[model samples]
Target: MAVTILGMDIGGTNLRSGFVNDRFELSEFRISSSQAICGEKAPENIAAYIERLMAETGIRPDAISIGFPSTLDKARKRLLSTPNLEGLDDMNMVERLENALHIPVYIDRDVNLLFLCDCHANHLTADVIIGCYVGTGFGNVIAIGGEILVGKNGVAAELGHIPVRGLTLDCPCGNVGCVEMIASGKALKTLQETWYPEEAIGTLFTLHASDEPVRGFINDLALPIATEINILDPDEIILGGGVLQMDGFPKGALEDAIRLHARKPYPEQALRFHYSGEKQENGVIGAAILAFRHMKREKGQPV
Candidate 1:
């Protein structure tokens, strides 16, 4: 029998959910406001939402997978911190949801799920892959041999938080000098408002491609990526996010900057870069894929 999986992507702004079958067909897609659903008694509210989804579709899920833009514990059972979703920190989401739905539940950082989906869609067969997404903030995920690498502290691959000297801006993570402070969409917006007040933020890259400050910003964006490449030497790197997808964003220039800062000789020359386009369904699809894989592994079946 084909497995039916329920996948949910909980973002800062929206909560998206969908059902995926074994053949990767998606149906019953729904989107809702994150804030409205995360009210007091959030766990109960989320469980009710899932129950309603199942009742309406008449298709009970074999397993549930959720992706959150937050830090999770090593076991992936509890959320360690959620900066955007207030009152969700330290919540035992997996336990609560599983108890309510009477099904297995799995959870992970949203970026990891996105990387999983991108890899599967791109047919990237590399044993080691790194995904760097420059969205509202810098999101990163590292996979080795098709499995995510969660360090002992369960906070591995936090490429965004890598400190950069001389950058004094405060990061939402309560740290100063983090690379994300100067290289993410938030940074670009600040620059757009400060330097090009008359121009729309979305068109900043298209209008000022040759501006020195813009070039410097692009360089800053590539520095953390190159640093990761030098440290991990992964077989392939996937770069994407809202920032890169902006109108007339300089993809080639960013690629060149990454190569320029990457280590000379060896891996730099051998590196394979894949740029993923923005997909609204990627998060939900990724959650389903991860859940399917997790279920198969638990059954001692080959994936």
Candidate 2:
């Protein structure tokens, strides 16, 4: 049986929405500024926005799924914290949105949604996998034995916050010197603004591929990734994000730097990796996948 699901990838900057069917085909994808609908009561704003979009598009979905950039509670009901987005802290979006929309609602970390999209798109099946996305911030997720690995508090796979030596940069998540402070897209933007303001950040790799600053930035990008490789030594790593998808980004150099930092003999020698190849609507489609899967499981259908 065919069914339509409404999926959204909500970020600090923008909101992406789309309709996805059981076949995993995405349609009517749209992006809008997140701020336009944000207010003191963000849940209401989100509900209203969905209502308006669905009314306009005339696609009333069987369920709604959202990918939010926030840590979730152990039960995946309440949002623990949302550093980048405002008006979303400590909210039970599942209850609120379901009440407002009168439909089944599902939510998860945005990167986990990205991981689902990566696996579905690439046809990857493995016992352990790590997804490291370098976008506005460092996003990470891990799967062990074919399940998303959530810690006791449901905030596992926060590899971005792993400590770094010889540095004391305060992170929004608190504490000092989280590797994200130096290894993420934010770090790269800082590097560009400091040293090569004349060149666009997107073109930094193309123009200064051999420059030390750019080269070092790439090396830092490898730091957290290599550290994860050292620890988990995942069967496959799905690397993706806006930074890596940019024109002229040096994928080879980044991979080499990762290998350079990886440990010897064990994890380094036989490491396998692949790119996520994510598209603009990848998260949106992944959200739908999550909803559809949940629906199937409730009906005792094989996923």
Per-residue accuracy of model 1 over 79-176 as CA lDDT, tens digit each? 88887787678889999988998999999998888888899889987888999999889999888887889999688988999998888999988899
Residue pair clashes in candidate 2: none
- The positional error of residue 162 in candidate 2, measured at the CA in angstroms, is 0.9
lDDT of 1 at 271: 80
How does residue 203 of candidate 2 score in lDDT?
84
- What candidate 2 gets wrong by more than 4 Å, as runs, is none
Taking all chains together, each candidate's TM-score versus the true structure is 0.96, 0.96
**Regions of model 1 farther than 4 Å from truth:** none
Model 2, residue 220: C-alpha shift (Å): 1.1
